[model samples]
Target: MKIKLEESTFGLLLASLLLIFGGVFSSAVQYDYTAVIDCLADPLKPQYNGGIIINPEINDGVKGWTTHGGVKIEQRSSISGNKYMVAHNRKQPYASVSHKVLLEKDKLYTFSAWIQVAGKNTTVTALFKTGDGFEKVGAVEAQVGCWSMFKGGISVASSTPAELYFESNDTSVDIWVDSVSLQPFTNEEWRSHQEQSIQKVRKSNMRLQVVDQNGRPIPNANITIQQNRLRFPLGASINQNIVRNTAYQNWFTQRFTVTTFENEMKWYTTENTQGREDYSAADSMLAFTSQHRISVRGHNIFWDDPQYQPWWVKNLSPQSLGPATDKRLNSVVSRYRGRVIAWDVNNENLHFNFYESKLGGGITNKFFQRTRQLDRRAMLFMNDYNTIEDGRDSTSSPSKYIAKLRQLQASLGANSVIGIGLEGHFHTVNIAYVRSALDTLAATRMPIWITELDVQAGPSQAAYFEQILREVHAHPGIQGIVIWGPWSQNGQCYQMCLVDPSFRNLAPGNVLDKLIHEWGGATAQATTNDNGYIDVSLFHGDYEAKFVPQGGRVDEVSPQGKSLSFAVDHNSSGQVIKFVSHV
Candidate 1:
């Protein structure tokens, strides 16, 4: 007898059977299927060494390895018989052990390794030397005594022979490496993996059973399931134009269920004169969103960039700036306390520190504490740019972001509610690096939101936009996404616009609509089997289900048919809804 089950259940059952049979089924699986199992698993010490790198674990004493820039290289073993490669006696920062590998064009290669420094902590970057120039794969802050996992990837336009190596600016420390891996995947394979992830993360399996009022099984019953609202917050940014223009309102309301006011809620716009404040524009915008039942994310309470601050506030002394900021925070958070769902408490603190440099080093912590006091229910976020967009900006790298988060958490206590807010403004999308960065930040287990996601204007803008949206949506760590594109009277936007001046759909807008429709659970019809059960897969959201008897009309609101509502969110599991029929 053959039985159908979910992939996870099947895997567990297969593993149990293998354990009982004692190696009978082990040899049948020859190829590495670990990628299919968990695509985001640690690249270092992967289940299979399928790449071109020889003796990746240094098991064969540095075989197929050579020195770069005349650096001394050797293989060493720990007391536990674990082997690793080390580059020492380096005269140049780029001097390290290297391996030559053939890379195919248009293939995405993800590289990872366990790296450590012999001395103090320093940044180590993985590089690929191709015909064009040196392409940076990824980087990690390597420290002494412990190993850090370095991850990054590159996609080439042309097939070429490339040399892979590691570089650290501090030439005084030796770069220790182990458990290296370089995995390549085609674009099609990458998309397939994304679909697989969406199935596992964003969807759930439901089994609905039909029965009579007397609890008897009723087969051949008609069932209908329709999505009411999507729980996943996929939205776009909006300016004050949405409050006035009917076309803008209709365009936005039809597509997004969540939004962030472009500049209406910012300090410079709200309190430009410092002493006098105006929230009429913001208030009107909030009212419109509230009437439409759309959720709003508080764009920010305070901006850390000096350039973004009000002219009057920037020149004030540290003592005066402290009280003014206090007043600003209290005014904003208290007014929109329960209105907003999440707050970017300190905006762009990782890049600039206007408040920190002027008010004091501990001003950011105080701002968060004050915001929490004002709105304890809302999630606080450290919203910043380039954290995942670019790998070169170590200032807002995932590691540095986490470090800053820890500092804030340490001051706020153990149970503080803080979130990772990545402002994803991209010129060119780096798929592997984005995934790796999210994986690194997911270790904190805090809620993460792509607060300001936008791809710059280019021929590949729409394609890159779709790629980024799919990648983030497929990842389980991301909670929500808000595009940075805000529509205006003119056909202009921050970097990318979804619609033209007529409020018609552009290329990116079409992609957005396509995904929105695809992810939604449009009305589906099915019939119960012999056991009076109808099995179906549904996306995570609120849904409405209806049932009708064998000879009953589904359109009629009579005793022959019944309707019910249920939610398919992260908490939903093994859901079985039984509907009682009057027939």
Candidate 2:
């Protein structure tokens, strides 16, 4: 019956202590249950790096791993990547850089590096394809190297795991690839790899074929090829989205990359204004051409005429205006220095009042000197209108241009000048004109190009297109044709759009498939059985080609005809031999 203070106090303290401990234990249990786990393995755990002759592995401590095909690994010292302990270098052209990583196709991943120029022309790349559909993805740049980093990335194809690649040109190039690895994302670890791959490929920059109503790679759509390699994957449908945006890039535009302008660089654009000397407009236009992957001709840098020369310069003595003209030449040529495939240093110097007569002879010489000074790489061309137009023998005019070209060469050395361009801007280009021009320019025994030939397609569109293609293809001296005004913006003068204003196929575009089919070979691969056939690698396009019972060497066409290009699904399977004769 006696109340004990100790007992009461002890019971209260015990009860309170138990409640506190229970609350703490409950929180610990809840925290453990809700915590996120990381099941993804770290990719960098593997060993890779080596050197060639001196030491085999990438570096002294670098390790190597294997995948498909034969691979060689070695360590190559580089000017850059000096901070990095060592560099992993490989020279296999077929598979320059390949990695097996945990990649869900559509996920956003970045593969970047500091690549230096090891050769005259070099490219650093990463390649991968989707499904049996074979949709490939990679990156390429023209003439880049060590001064800075060359970077590229693309979304991967959905579904099938691809042989991811990074390759470069055969021309000896030392690419210091550092910080090379796959990127991270939230959904890649948790969600579907297919969706992630789809996003990767969808956001990628490489061109792909379009889909049909059935969501298959469009069969006959034209896409560009690069470095003698097929643009798209062998069996994958090209992402139509990729092509529409990339139609203008140089190599990625189509299998058949061509010149859009022939000889439109003229007095109008160059000397449009009077005394106000200007070249920013021309530079912008040239940059645009380069960006769109279009090549250009110089037109005529110095044409003999009252209009070509500024009104103020005409009255001034040639000697007085020399500095300003030199400045003009330097600016014009330098702005488009390497970008221009070729340039007409002085147009029609022999026929018209050239800078030689007014300024002095060897003015063409000065022009070439200045051009080479800025860009020793650009091909200096001497172009002239009418010398090769209308099927007439350009015996007099072309002969004169050639004579001057020869004289220039004689004065300098044989290699001083690279090529002689013949401007063939014609109202109606005839076979005779082509022959006459070639015949005259051939006398010079120099490399020649048909600078501008706008073959009128009013009534004779089909005939003219066939004739031009055949003639140009046959000419040996002629390097290539630059068709001026090929597009609407360019062809405003000649209405040269292959697809007319109404978006209809123009004369040239209509029969172009046939020409390509005849010349383009069908390098068929894979053998068809119950489920078609299989081949390791096949180039893209319609494979608009024909092969004999015994197909010639791999990637070779029959003597009967040229192999045509074809479109294949990046994800299609089997030994598939398409028997279509014409594209």
Candidate 3:
């Protein structure tokens, strides 16, 4: 009764199934599972086929590869008969194998390679020596025994001849590389991939069929679907101004279903005078958000930056600092335990380590453990900036982030629930780098959210904001996004503002509104077919459907309109709902 089929055979069978079920379930959505299977089956294999690199597989004995920076290049084979290129006896960091290739102007090129090291683990960077200078395309931590895949890309502004090379800072280790690939894609092709990913990940098909009591088809019924809530958490940060300003409340509540206070819940804000505490502003904001059914992400429990600490706590001894931090954690976390969805436990821990430097190295782990105990339902996040926004920041790179996460996991045990919160504050958007960074972090399989997203103020600010939003939303790894821009009456914002003083939308605000509309914020209408069935693809959310009998007056059929509530989610692919008609 059981059968095992080869990949090609399974593909043929999948095609047959599609043909067989395509008409019988015309209203249901069909997904091609071949790609998923292929990805999971052989992840170490190279994905690019049309790359420009010559002798990428090393089968021709390193015909196209040459020594760079006076190193030795040779083609070697493994016991399994797999050929690879090796660069040995390195004197400098950039001493490795190099390949020259002509790159096109205004094109995006994605690079990948399988690498390993002869001795200890080291970070290997893939670089391109272009007409301008040396450009780092990608990097990976190469290990001793196993092969690791390095993925990254670069966008060129002008056509130039470039020499692609690999580099390792450790001169004692020999680098082994295989399956080198450099594939280029046009802007249109890249956008098309994003759209396709969005359609597959964020949407589901729903089929509505109307029938009489006797199971007879009631044709020509008008169906109206209005989305009530979007499941994807697209929200913004808010300041205390929202508590009393009616215009501010309206503007915020209309678009966002989630929010985070700008500063109300921080340790410095709540306990400025050490023993004295205040939660009135935070309580009021929470009340407003609770009334509107908006979920909140706790802005922070503590800040690692020395400048952001409370004035009174700065001069405290280690003994006093420990107790004071415990009190702060208990007061805030216990006060709003079940109300918030996530907590930025130690904000900017990677960039600054005020508590760590004063208390000890174990302070952050202790805080995370205690926060989990206090608010068991909330996700504890390690939030930091520049991990994805600026790849040049080695202090908070994706690899470093993962290393910190692993250290915490080792200390907290395997079952600890931690979230990755990247504060996406950017100036000029780098689309390829962003995607590659996300891909690298997503390998950990941890829940990732863009905690504080904003672009610097400029003429291209709106465009960059739109690019970031689209790219993050299209990525399946990103679970949520919260914009950092908060509105003020004087038009002063952290970096970018969605609206001006008069409550009119700014350019960035307009971009957000347009995207919200495209992602199922607008009401839609459709008519049933001859079989009383209507199929539609919708973003995952709560929806209200109204059925109007054909040829009947709008008010004549039920004044309230024959309506029903339904939900569309990832598991709603073949979901069928039947509405009974009295007419």
Candidate 4:
């Protein structure tokens, strides 16, 4: 029989039905709802702790490990759980202890350890098995001194077992290690952490504007903003006419964020390019660059290229070599102590060593020590080339580079060598190899800079250049990039020029412009939305915001001025700056 049910009874009946079949109904609803939360867990995210390397803390007295060349366990209360491993090598150049660990294919693994050096420097090397042989995944050098943390990692290209070894090059020092760890992380997690590290330390920002006494928006004004202390140096080499040529100057200011005087600042150019210390050009260049707020990189205090050394010093005997080295370092570094950002103390030590032969092996240490003393603020770098090129298995391989750095650290202490400069002169690049090289160098916890990056001129030059720049920018370990090619009129540059001398963008230049303005970082432009407000996202740095009367015009001469200038900062949130146009 058909019977009418009251509203309350029907509601109760529906509630009862929902209680009984809620699970199925909920699933059906979720299937139809497009905005539902993803119920699946991310597989890339590690679900468990990575495989353990036995005796990582040396808690078991070096058990579950192969000891080679005077490896022993030390009991120290300061260390975790009061125990650590010490590899003391006094006779031979090699001493190490390694623990084998299994790693997954196509996964990123990071290996780290707490290390202390007593006499000289030591290194932690990671090796993986490949068809060819044991390929070095990465190596990290520990500075000689008190306990320091060093780390390195690799993305396993295949399913292979890896070994983490701590090696002391010689009997020069006692290497101590503890708290070793091999951990796996997803790319997303790694990049998220890196972003945290990058933004953890905030710099103060300034918000400025130029206008008349009355508040008005000045649009399309010529503006220049210079950073006081450059943590990142995105720059390019300036042409010979940088100071005089309008095109060159405009291109330098608009495109490059950092400045490297092409030939004017080099040792040969400054001291003896003309067989005399005619720094007239260099002095003028430095002044103009400084005024424009472009940080300069001391290309070289001394050039080791045998064909490029000054004639007077080339014939100098061993006795006078040290003094000549000191004079040159003192003269160049002392003059621009606070002005230039970093000094390429000895250029390409890996490629040549004229000074080493004449002044002995101590020249590098002395150069660093003297540069440190003269300009304590500027970083001292040993610049080199071919360190991260496609064919790296040859002489200037990453392993060879790591070994050289270890020797320098052993003699000069870790603080002496503050930066690693790689002249990224590329014909072709193996991106995987480049990433591996950067990972190995990052272990030292030093700033890794692409000091002279430029691709060879080719049909694919633009593509290759863009690819390299993207890779560098993607890496958190990389500090900055400085291109070493000029925008020559005839496209005959040292490498690939970014622009034509007519100030027109070439292919490479187009890619670079996109990276700088659209992808890498961005600038915001909009008229005040009734409230004289515009919002923009910027990487932490100094900025110059130009405002003018917006009517689709670049610039216009007002009774007061053509445009207004504003120096503004986005250091914190909720920042509102006012610019009263005096013009």
Candidate 5:
């Protein structure tokens, strides 16, 4: 017989039936297993053999590879399974080995190999033929003795077929290349590889507190921990007045986290190469940075570029260059020893060797050693340009620059050069090339700073600026970036300045401003609750907290009742902070 039952009673009866035959009922539960099964399985990345080259090992002797200019099969030391190809410079400028491959549009390909230098420093560059010319994908400096593995990637923009090749240059060195491989990486794989190489440097959390002179908690403190990364000195640069200009200063103050006195601290500008010092401009620049509580980078202790050198330095006899260098370095470094955090010991040593040409190559070693001796506190940097912006073939490619640093490190005992300064002066940028260069230099394990980063004024300047800034921020190896200017001479316009002459933000400057504010560093108001304490977290930087005391009746003379302003910097961890409000 059918029994009439309420909805609740019927559900209970159904649950009871299911419980009595759990295994039978479970089969009818109905579940989607596709996503779960896929999650449990490993990801697949397909590799096509003989797609790019056959017998890449070259053990069978350059069978499928074509030689360009002076390349041959060599029995030299092998990187992997034995046998390799050697590109002999033999006093010539360049030699290369190449293989042709048909690539699809929009696919990403990476070409990698193990290479070693038989003689002097060897530079290996990855290239692809483009409509206009050969495009350089990556370059690396292989050491003379050991095998170094290097790889570079390319994003195919068009469906056109191109020959992918590895070329070695430098009259002084011969290169042995082995185990060449060309393969396509999935988006996930490429991103994962990039993420793995990126250094993990998390943003620091700053803990802050406010208290009165009697050590009592000061409730209702208005805290402004405005983190101007420009002020924090993240993408910092040398400037005389952006920190002080009314129309432009706000953009600079709110955006940049650091400052550098570009011309004020130069040897020629400071001493005029006559040994007479002018501390006024430099002092002002330092004071401005100090008042803002931003870090400062010393532009240069010595710059030996021939055309830019002081007239007196040029006239100095070969023997006098040494003494002049010593005097200049000692005088400048001693003045700003503890104040400046980093010093460009000798600017553009990679591009120019005026001092080296005259005082001998050993002079650069002496320059670093001497700088370290006097200014033992600061990070001494060997500043140069084109290391990242120019391709591997340029005089200042990452591979060549690293080799130069290695030479300096070998002679100066390692500690002499503590930082690598990359002058990121670019007109056009290839993100892949820049990333590859930085990755190669990161192998040095030294802190890398974008010393003179600026994009030229152009239609795409703003877009390029944002792209590069994001790239730099994403890279773990990049410690900080120092931009070139707020404006160039005569207001003609230059790359990297945030504001125009009218104090209006250029597109890039606006981008800079938006980034700084979006980081959301400071809390406008954090009132203390009934417990008479307010705990807040901030970005790792300096802060100013204004404490407004309550409870006392307001007087006509002091309506706010004696508000106290305290300048404090937040440490890594949020700690119980006691601020002495009254003296």
Candidate 6:
């Protein structure tokens, strides 16, 4: 059952249980996922550009990977000279070392790599960071090292379709990369990523700088910053020791021009304060996602719980939560009608006992009516966990969760219910349960997503990622999988991060790569002017405006790329056409 964020029952239980839970899973790699792609190229040779880790002196006696018209193609160690040397691919192309991976929506990923550029711009650098559907990183920098053996690594964050690279701000620089890898980082790990290394703590010349929103600098901001993570598990991270790095490296080929809600829209925090009806958080999420041209899910327009509704709701004298709730729903919805694309009309009704028991049998209908009345254009979904096979029996049960959902669909009339959210927040949850859940949910003819998934504790976690992803990807009805908390830093609940605090990738993060950006078949085109303005019609996927080129595609791009997922939206009347330009 969905619990409120402030619910002490679970919070106290979890807090009390945290010791046991933490101990039980301590050595289990907290992260069990694996790495998928491997950059086996070597640098120092004229042909290999910056995509390798070793420094091999090629003198017509050896061969290696090289670049042409910007695309790095794998060639047997043949011609080793400046002629066949490094030319940045205006297009970022990559040679495949592909392995199977599973990516869940909502889960965060932490990507780390050692990248260095000495002279010319490192365009189409290594596939520094990429994935099927992720778009942005706040900041990264080109670090310096004495040599290949001492190359420096930069830590960054990414979602699915992860990316990593040495984006050269200077056009006349050469960058070398080695030991590039990515893994998932959960909430707690996020806290730990910023911890001070024992060595750094002992440094004498280390002077810390404090800054503010405009970057004018602030002396006291450090105090507030430190307070944020203070209660976290790691001591220094709580000190707000994370660097306020400027000129952060932008690795992806695309930017999430649009914005999104917190953690793919959870039911708990959305309206926990009740009559207060504060949507600042959600509005901020949508607006950010939208400004970045990122599409966002409306999460759930209707979840069945008193906490979701204001206390004034349950106290409705005549039983109605008042036109305020309805008006609020309609107001918030209508504001984002076209921009916000999807909605979970109802969330986990089958998992809990709700107001429907007291209200008439109209729980589902009321939700649909309000949503349709406001955002008539949004896609509506009936989201639930346990949609896969039953965890208890491992059999695709038509009688339990799916059955109730189907009954709700029939009762609510199928037209209003557009999809299913098979949230795989498994505690003891298994792939069999997820698979079965999707099979039955798909029978309703609605597209599905593995909404809020968490591959709970132990060595089996990585395998859990692979199994669930393989099964989910194999299913035609599953459109997306939003894993709960990709990083440990933001996890309000537990420690399910794919990578731990040390900026390491878990095996699961590796497997999920295939699921994220590797959906394949992508092409991009855009134009820029002296004002650095550009206009273009990108496809229904992620894209970045880069001067660098990948393999087999267009050009006039930036050394750094940005992406936004573009999907079709058909209105009953006609298609909603949009024209956008980015700076």
Candidate 4 lands at a TM-score of: 0.60
For residues 422-493, what per-residue lDDT tens digits would candidate 3 score against the true structure?
A: 999999776777777787777777899999999999999999999899989988788999999657779998
Per-candidate local distance difference test: 0.80, 0.44, 0.81, 0.61, 0.63, 0.39
Listed per candidate, the RMSD to the true structure in angstroms reads 5.8, 27.9, 6.4, 13.4, 12.9, 25.8
Q: Write the per-residue lDDT of candidate 6 for residues 74-187, one digit (tens) a residue.
A: 212323322212223334223221212233353333332333444532222223334543222211233332222111112223334333333333444444433333343333
How do the candidates rank by TM-score, highest first? 3, 1, 5, 4, 2, 6
Summarize candidate 4's per-residue lDDT along 1-583 as a digit string, tens digits. Answer: 2222234454344333332332221111111000101111111111122236676666677776665555553444442235666765445543556677777674465555566667655554444444435555444445554554433445565666665565444557776666666666443333333333333222222344444456665544333233322335688887567778877787777666677777776766776733366768878888778788888888788777788787667777888767777777788787788988888888888888888888778788778777887887887787888777643233455556666776767766746557888889999655545655665566666788898889998888998898688667656567778988757757688888787878788898888888675332454454544344444323445554454554534345354443333332334433555555443
Give the Å error, residue 116, model 3: 2.3
Indicate the residue-level lDDT of 316 in model 5. 89
**Candidate 3 C-alpha error for residue 162, in Å:** 2.3
**Which digits, one per residue and each the tens of the lDDT, describe model 2 over residues 1-583?**
2222234454344333322232221111110001001111111211111101111223442233233234443345445323221213444654443444444554444333333334554444445544553222323332333332222233434544555544554525543333343342222121122222222221121222233334433343322222233222111001112223334232224434434233234434455554455554555555555564545566556666565665656776777767757866775676666776677777665556646667777677777777777877878776666655532222324434555676777655666765776555455543433443454455455777766555554787666666665555444345665554444433353535454433345676666546444333333233323322222233222334323233244245334323434454434333333333221
Cα-based RMSD of candidate 2: 27.9
Order of models, best lDDT first: 3, 1, 5, 4, 2, 6
Evaluation by TM-score, superior candidate among 1 and 4: 1
* TM-score of model 2 vs. true structure: 0.44
Model 6 lDDT, residue 308, Cα:
61
**Candidate 4, residue 361: CA error in Å?**
5.2
The residue-by-residue lDDT of candidate 1 on 1-583, one tens digit each, is 3323335455455444432332233322221222211122222474246266788888888898899989999998766667789999988989999999999986677776778788788888888899989887777777787667756667787999999998988999999888777887766545545555566677777788888878888888888888888888988899987877899999888778899999999999999996899999989999999999999999889988888988999889988988998899999999998999999998999999888888789989999888888898988999999878987777887767877998999888987768999989999988877877777777677899999998999999999999999989977678899998756578878898898988888898988888988787358889999989988767888888788556766666564537778889755756888877665
Model 5 weakest lDDT span, ten residues long: 31-40
